[model samples]
Target chain A: MDNNIIRFTYNVDGTDFTSAGQASVMLKKNLRQLGISPDTIRRASIAMYEGEINMVIHADGGVAEIEVSEECITIMLKDSGPGIKDINQAMQEGFSTAPDDVRSLGFGAGMGLPNMKRYSDHMEIESELGVGTTITMKINI
Target chain B: MKITTVKELLEAKVVWGEELIGKHVYSACGSDMMSDVLAYVKDQSVLLTGLVNSQVIRTAEMMDMVCIVFVRSKVPNQEMIELAKESGIVLLATDKRLYDACGILYSNGLCGNGVRRG
Candidate 1:
């Protein structure tokens, strides 16, 4: 069996709320070109998009790394923001620390992390209060 | 329902992608929170939102949604229009409130159960 992997990296800009989902959008197009199934593409893009939006809203942006293989797709999101204080609490639906303004922009309903988990086949989160946070998710193709 | 029917039922003005109105949409959902919208992406082809932003278009695009109805006559910005145009997602604006717009469509047979167009 040949083990081949394609990788793509995108810089999430924390300053701009409007451009948050750009990476996921581009990734969707790329995956389409690779002839990935629409269902898989939708799941991966939605999961990555939630992560990207969270990076901008909570972590002041970060780096998103995507790895695509024949069997699965892996997404790694790393951020250097204040970090998640309680992973369990943050994982709960509708539990949000995002301010009032973000809600007006049609996000921050506290569904980001949970939605990422819901769409992916597997998910993991690592965080330190003062240091940073990293989230890894995988979807089986 | 075809996207053109959604436009007529809501009395919506086309913001972009007027040429693509002949497309058909199976199911529909209405929400301002994009995350909530993302949670229910089960073949939902039409998105009704009052929230105006580029991510709105991007969300519809990610879901493979063919149309977005902007309730309450809320107009999307240039960036949003351009984004929808780029993705070939039709954008429509209506003066009706979210609930009424959704109700109208639901009463007319468009549903939220992710039904397939027959």
Candidate 2:
């Protein structure tokens, strides 16, 4: 726990798709108040947003924690649901297991993890078959 | 181009942010899939979509987009409108379809060539 690091924790609710992105929206506001760069804020916000949506769609919700430091911003998402069977396949663009209804809502397009990785400087995913999944992503400030 | 110009080009009805129409935008992208929008879009100030959801507003907010145009006359619900209002993102609805709305805006100088960054 560095003195300069600020942490935020949020509980993402999987029951409601309409409220899926609330965490990301809050993070964006908090980052702006901290006077972080807009690009950095956008990157962090977008990456976390995709993660938030994933948790709701696939993981039945999760806990998201964001830590801000002088070096970079780190996002940690943990979800308890059907874990991804193949991380590599899940990482591939256009490879989604989301139901058809999710697609109608403008998500579940198989771009979540890829988008998270694309926006962040670094990302790592850890998942177990029936246990859960944890994703860690970092964005350089 | 100005938001006013976008409104005119697409003949869009401002669902919200009428006062903000004076704002200017440089680039725009049209996508119903928020995934692709998050994946490839950069510095895109406007989003045109047929998808109606609060996530759409959240996606635009995440991208720092200032305006959203709902093509095919799709009306956003109250919750979505509130979210957009909170984010200060303008909302516009048009009777034109997605392709037609995008074509009009592109032909009117609102290019999709967003400034890319690595």
Candidate 3:
């Protein structure tokens, strides 16, 4: 029995901007029910939420996998869309290629990657020009 | 400050969560950008924004905020109200635009991360 770990998976719908953060909200509820520390839950959810939004804005939607453990929580966001051309620049604050429409929604200030980096204890981005992008972030519980 | 105080100060309409108005909130962040709210915010228990969408409520939920104030006469639709209801977050709408609403709260001592990060 894997007493140390629990996992959850979600399919993010890309078409609707309004539905973008639903996965993160669900994850927050799951964390609360698991009795995770509030700080840890906040950090994990913040990181995951930013990734989920980025997936919608850039990749048209994706899949998020969440794993909770005694030590830490890990979230992986994978998208098969026009991959990030420059991970370095994308990680920079205030640099974004998200369409203006996304900006109107109060996102696309180029803070997604930076926010994820700031909240997560560890962050990784794997992106290819036209293939896809996968971001993995971990926050210690 | 109690959530009811926020309502009085902003002269805001109670869109949802009337039952939560009596709850107390220590700090607040005002931002239209949801990610900014998520990033620059820490320990703030209230969210003030002009954005009307489901993510607004979700952002509040992720940050563990107790209340959300929509500025500039912006009101969330039915779906957003349902989301807030599920999260037990108090919702208010003010004809007071973002700057005025946030400023009034700020002068009244309801604040953010102490560094004005948001």
Q: lDDT per prediction?
A: 0.91, 0.92, 0.88
I-RMSD for candidate 1: 4.9
Report the lDDT tens digits of candidate 2 across residue range B1-118: 9999999888889999999999999999999998878876667999999999998999999999999999988999999999999999999999999999998888888889754334
Could you give the TM-score of chain B for each candidate, in order? 0.94, 0.94, 0.93
The positional error of residue A119 in candidate 1, measured at the CA in angstroms, is 0.4
DockQ of 3: 0.65
Per TM-score, the best of the predicted structures is: 2
Q: TM-scores for chain A, candidates in order?
A: 0.97, 0.98, 0.96
Rank candidates, lDDT, best first. Answer: 2, 1, 3
Off by over 4 Å in 2: B115-118
Worst 10 residues of 2 chain B by lDDT: B109-118
Considering only N, C-alpha and C atoms within 3 Å, which residue pairs clash in candidate 2?
none
lDDT value for candidate 2?
0.92
For model 1, the superposed segments whose C-alpha errors exceed 4 Å read A1-3, B114-118
Task: Supply candidate 1's per-residue lDDT for B113.
Answer: 74
Give all TM-scores, in the order shown.
0.96, 0.97, 0.95
List the TM-score for candidate 3's chain B.
Answer: 0.93
- Per-model root-mean-square deviation over C-alphas: 2.7, 1.2, 1.9
Model 2 achieves a DockQ score of: 0.79
